[model samples]
Target chain A: MYDHKTRILYVEDSLADINLFKEFIDDKVELTVVSDGQSAKSYLHRLKQTKSHFPNLIILDINLPEISGFELLNLIKKEQRLKFIPTVMFSSSDNQRDIKDAFSQAANGYVVKPGDLGDYSRAIETFMNYWVYTCKLPQEQ
Target chain B: MLSKVSTFKTVLENLSDGISIIDKEGKHVWINKAMATITGFTKEELLKSSPPHIYWPEEELDTIMKALGETMEGKFRNFELIFVRKSGVRFPVLVNPSPIENDEGEVQYFVATVKDLTEVRRVQHELDDLAYNYRVLHDNTSELICRHELDGRYKSVSPSSIRITGYRPDELIGRDPYEFIKEDHLEQVRQNLHEQALAGNDLIRTQYEAKRKDGTIIWLDTITKTLLDENQKPTELVTISREITELKSLQTKLEENNRELKRSNMELENFAYIASHDLKEPLRTIDNYVQLFEMRYSHVLDDKARQYFEFIKSSAKHSIQLTEDLLNYSRLNSSEFPYKEVDMNEVLENVCSQLQSRIAKSQAKLVYDKNMPSLVGSHILLSRLFINLIANSIKFKSEEKPLIRIAVKETINAWQFSVSDNGVGIPKKSRKEVFEIFRRLRTTDDEKGSGMGLTICKRIVEKHQGEIWIEANEPKGSTFKFTISKHLKESTNV
Candidate 1:
């Protein structure tokens, strides 16, 4: 199982989610934030140039400004270190067509970002509880 | 007296009809068996009839005598009256009298002949009943038979005209024919009619619009003929016309609705073209970016990661091909592709020459015979149609050798051409399904396909009013058979 203080990379566009996620998850795990795909891609490239910052998990959004979330997912899925990181699709659209498309692209899991704070809290809690506590993850030291 | 009595008896027996003789004093002087039978009386009872009592009133007899007195001077006289038989049967009679005078100039005797009129009267009654029934039938059905002089005056019109046009026959008697036509279209109607008539042609079964008394227009489907006078020169127009405006209006509306539906379909096809084209831009960027990463860091990607990258690269390339096929399919439905006669033999040769390398590498023998009849259709689309079929035949072939044979034959309406290949054949039940998008018969394990080629072929064939179907080639192959008609205009003329 992954450690309680495993460093994680979370790429998100919403500031409120950033604030809420940091407040909820900072005590459970170390969270490194990237505001948009540009920062996320740049950070990833920088890591590739030196020692790889292999995070335990990566949460992705499908809709991004410069590059689409799908393109980033495809890129990460193609990488040796990142392909096994248990990436989850976190998007605002609950469209069934988009969901089917995500699964067809072999995504690990898809999570719809609800506006309700309670639902968001439950969803985030469930995702973390399964991945961090119950299920096993690579804990290479 | 005895001799004269015998002579009178002989005269009465020889007459064809019932006859009686009465003297000047109006007493029945003689009677015959024919007269007794006709009057339904015995001969013994009919002789010695009272003056003017049998056939006429006493007063009418006096008037007859007065008229006959003038005719006695030199004229032949005729008289008619009704007589009752002994059985009370009544019949009309005519009497012709010839006066015979003595030397003293006194009117001594007048010989009168009486003829029964029942037979003639029976015939006349039958004729009158037939004429009455004919008139009633014309009135009920709104059929008017009109006879007009060449000068366009009404010679005769049945009472039926009133019910049809709300105009009495008398009112139409002197009216001009052109006056009945709506004023706006009157000139055109007149020009058409005058030209036909002057060319010695009778306008038969023509349709025109006429204004009623209230200015409401109605269509008249009329049939007319020429009426010739004694000189045999055409002098009149006799026409039969019925109304059909309501039927014509309904047909016009139906056609208009069909036109609107067709326009909407065309707009949808245009949207398909635009969406397919726009989706390509982003796809190109991903492909280019992925290529850059591979070129820059070939050594860094581990075997496991490299395998994942290979899948992604293949997916992008496959997507681009699918997009092109979709674009081509939608482009066909976007605009009206004007067509002309295209020679199939020439088209097949050009396409084969283009795909020569694909044919050589696959060891495929593409055989297309020459002298195929010309088909009337769009060359560009037809060329696309042949290229897709030929490529598929070449692409999917038996491992040893790929052989394709192209042959053509003329059928009832169109020319049938078959492109047979030694490639894998589609199953019988799945033949129709092969024409749908992404409906690959075999799994993509061996060969990849978009499954749009047959669908495109079906669409193009239908547009030309033709058909396409699949049949099995000998051994192990599928033969694609399609037909396009001989030049449509030329076929219609023949």
Candidate 2:
């Protein structure tokens, strides 16, 4: 049953947003959460060693503790093995500079958190439909 | 020739020069009428004197005898000497002597002619004094005065060259002035001179950087003029230069400070934008949670609980609007917006349609001319400006259907626009205070506004390099008047 599901790794610092994302996903995918850039980097490093435990998708928050999402994204894009996995920037910031910066750092996509619950739910649902159903990803191994 | 002896004697008597004949024994044998006048003596006294006569100054008697002995030997020449008159006054004279020969060719006596030289000596002394004064002025002045040949070679340089260029006059003369000019300015200087020559400009002023003899750079302010010959043809160029290095450096420092101030101001605007952006996240969370609470527990909630939720939701929404308005206000000062030609009529139409529901609900009518102008400004900003004005007119209506008139007038250097409204007018005392940021006449509970609309409009006008203010209408309303500079270009920035 788990083998057929998509795996997602979320790196975020806000507790409210983390809880919201957990509720929105609702076991539709195999999700793992890390609260800071350092732990997320450690988890990715371990996944690189295991080779078969890599997630199909990664979601990064631009503002984080310890290390910034932009610095972590730069490190991930530079690694040959991790560069294959698609990374998306999910943040409440709708600033054009942040969006442009995300793309310039080789992020696969950018999503702005909506202001209301209904809009946020719809936006996440659409995002899941696109990434899990429509777009294809590299093999886990 | 023998019969004309008397005529020769008559010519000698009338001559301007004094003439005398002396014997070998130093006795005066004959004298002309000029000689008697020149010696200040009668013929009898002059003829009676022998050697050391009164006509010769006593200080030069020995030299006079030596010269007389030389002249008696038939070796005649002109000599300068001082002669004393009988009145004891001494004067300079030029004496020319020749021997008088007999028929047998033996020297018998000497004939001498004397010319007065007092006027020539006096004029020579005046010329020498003038030259001394000119030399004193040229060497002592602080300005670097120089004369250059037509080809730019230094013909003469003042002593001040040492102070201005760190070079002595000897080192600079005969060298091309271009050699001392900085390489970056060489071509420009050459072009300037070439153009002046072609136009026959008598005087031109220019400034440029130059390298001194010690390789230190300095700025020179120079004025050059062509020295013309008698035929009005260009002969040489006279240039006067002064060192302006201190002034140039001060100007450079001022420019640098201006750039630094602009950078810091941009940073402040960016800070405001980012702070407002961060503030929105928490507001969104509060709004979403309140809505989620209502969706889950509405059935069990009473009137009081529902009222509290509504208050929380509305407050969150209001705060969200405030942050968004602040963000847009900051964006107006940034360089992201493009300045281009925009039609005011189109901008007004866009603003009207955006506020169509509000306008209809309030039964407000907008009267505007269709012949609006195209101006250089940001289209989005101008539309926002109009929307805020029209919306305020509708919002503050005074128990009557609102009538807003948008008009434009052409001035010499700008287009003045007026937005008049038949509504509660602003008091004269509060007109200036309304433009201040976050300053509102009405309380927040009475008016549903972020209090940033007028502030944003003021910023937009300022960005266009124009002014905006309020004027009381003739009877019972307020008119908002603003101007747009007709000469604004596409590159203008906030």
Per-residue lDDT tens digits for candidate 1, residues B211-310, read 8887788877776777666876777777777777886687688889889878887777767666666655455545554665576676799999999998
Which CAPRI category fits model 2? medium
lDDT of 1 at B145: 74
With candidate 1 superimposed using the best TM-score fit, by how many Å does residue B66's alpha carbon deviate from the native?
A: 40
Off by over 4 Å in 1: A1-141, B1-148, B151-174, B197-208, B220-235, B238-242, B293-315, B333-341, B361-363, B374-376, B392-403, B410-416, B420-446, B462-481, B485-494
List model 2 lDDT by residue over A12-107, tens digit each: 998888888776776758899999999999999888777656777788998998798888888888887888667889998877778999999999
Q: Compose the digit string of candidate 2's lDDT tens values, residues B1-494.
A: 55698998889888888888888876889888888887798989999898888788888788788888888777788988888888988878888988888999988988888777777889988998898887887897777899988888999999989998999999999999999999998887777763475355856777899999889999988877887779888888888888899989999999999999989988988998888888888887787777777788887889998888788888998899899888888988867667889999899999999999999999999999999999888898889889988988888777779999999999998889999998998999988888888777774474778878889988988888789999997677899998888887886554
Model 2 TM-score relative to the real fold: 0.56
C-alpha lDDT (0 to 100) for residue A92 of candidate 2: 83
Window of ten residues with lowest summed lDDT in model 1 chain B: B485-494
Residue B205's C-alpha lDDT in candidate 2?
71
